[model samples]
Target: MMTCIVIDDEPLARSLLAQHIADVPFLEHRGSFKNALLAADFLSKNQVDVLFLDIQMPKLTGIDFLKSLQHPPKVIFTTAYREYAVESYELQAHDYLLKPITFERFFTAVSRLQVATPKVIETPIPETATTPEHIFVHVNKKHIKVILEDVTYIESIKDYLKIHTTKETLVIKERISHFIEQLPNPPFIRVHRSYIVNRDHITAFTQQDIEIGDIEIPIGGTYKEEVLNILKAP
Candidate 1:
């Protein structure tokens, strides 16, 4: 079972989340706190599998508290503000739930957490084995295998992602955040909120945009530093 804690100043919100936790068979509710400071203290002494954190709180805001952690647990941000969504993703939050959260929505978020969690393979790898060169994605009720080397870029369109390969573009109904976690690093890097480009395909780049073939993708302000570092790496 996955152990979790709720950190929110609102009494009603805490109570409601506690009830939801009890309803989930795979989730064990460890504790609930009214502030980030209290939660930090508890976290220092113990570890949990997941954290349901509020974005805004007195003394220390949730975002600031999360940033302070050297090794943070999987976090699901529970907040009333929609503006914090982008920042939450930048922090690699497991999920974001808006205030007045329903049981259905909460379930969906946890379900995603379960799916995103990496599984361990006990089978041993051969000494000469190499990493898989392709990834399979579900599209139109069929699993389509994509060559990693051929992918030029990925574009997020609402709830779906457009995977642009050397041959063609495939539209898959999946979140960009999900792809970010699943895709291999090095060649793939998120340049913008809506774009993930293959560094191998990048013929040119600037502080403002990245050029892959003839398509120029904007570099988000928040992602500039990481993008530049990756591009400059030897």
Candidate 2:
């Protein structure tokens, strides 16, 4: 079993993470602390496998705290901020989670600690049943229905996402990664950190970028190889 801890300034955040740890069969909740300073002392005394850390704490931010540790454990950053995403990944963070964590997302992050190749837990379907064709997203003040085939691409704008479709562009307050989890893979693929393109709508492509009609989206360096492989697949 892997021993873990939650370090967040907010009491509610700490409590929520601790509860998540409890739910995971392999994770043993060692303790929960309100600050990184308190967790520092605990780390010195104990053996921790994972840390569910919050970025915007009072005394020392989560990024600084991880840098200070000579032998830090696998860390999963939990915060509302999207700006620190690059820095956290640079530090080799296990995963990054945005605020108001859902149990599904939380489980996905923590599951990585146990497996090298993590997968989405799929529910077995009956032979006659069909997959969903559309998804409802919260846009403006109401749930908007968007057909899967209608979406051309999705762009990340800070904490919000701009979903471009054949008919309209719908703006929604959500993380691009979280939003992508709802869509099927073959038709929808992430081309860059800031963009997810529908392969069916892709008109053209080069090693550096992909073109969907007139708009061109740059392929991220790290994702280029995989993106090209998918695009070239028969």
Candidate 3:
């Protein structure tokens, strides 16, 4: 279960979120606050997994409050303004929900939180064994196993990632960095800031871009030399 709190100035909004939280079987609504200050104070003494926060408020805004925390919980911004969407993602918010949030949208955001939440594997690891060749990605609340060898590339879209595999494309609300950590070297290389291509899938390459299965991926200026070196290696 994920413990959560709502920080919104509007009473109706708070009530709605509280109700929504109650409806979700995996979510536990801890408390609701009128402002970020109160929420911050409460957070100091409590352990929370998710925060449903409003963008605009008196005393301190949700964005400012989130910045104040040295280590903030997974935040799902709840606001009426759409302009704050980019800024919210820049802060690595789990998800953003515009005002008048419906149950479906709320459920989607919470589902993402569940998928992104790191799980501890109790089994001990063998030191000599190499990293696994596949990973399990959460999509639509389900964990789907994906083989790294079958992946053509990965694309970043705002708060989500599109995993392009040989068979299909899987979309998930996760960071590219997360995949980079899982994908082993040599086969997977970050060719661009918004893309990571599988080296084994590459059909052709130039200094500026790489061609993989009829798709051409641009090579970022920073990654050019490394990409060329890797591809040209004997």
- Ranking 1 against 3 by lDDT, winner: 1
Residue range with the least summed lDDT across 10 consecutive positions in model 1: 113-122
RMSD of each: 2.6, 8.3, 6.8
Instruction: Write down the TM-score of every candidate.
Output: 0.85, 0.59, 0.64
lDDT of 1 by residue, 55-164 (tens): 99999999999999989999999999999998898777888999899999999999888887766568996799765689999988999999999999999987889999
Across residues 36-110, which tens digit of lDDT does each residue of candidate 2 receive? Answer: 999999999998888899999998999999989989988899999999988786465778999889889999887
Report clash pairs, candidate 2: none
Model 1 misplaced regions, further than 4 Å: 120-129
Q: lDDT: which candidate is best?
A: 1
TM-score ranking of the models: 1, 3, 2
Q: After superposition, how far is residue 104 of candidate 2 from its true place, in Å?
A: 16
Stretches of candidate 2 above 4 Å error?
A: 1-20, 23-75, 78-83, 87-129
The alpha-carbon lDDT assigned to residue 48 of candidate 1 equals 93
Q: What is the C-alpha lDDT of each candidate?
A: 0.91, 0.86, 0.87
- Candidate 3 local lDDT, 55-127, one digit each (tens): 9999899999998998898899999999997677656677789889999999998886787676756788678
What are the clashing pairs of model 1?
Answer: none
Better of 1 and 2 by lDDT: 1
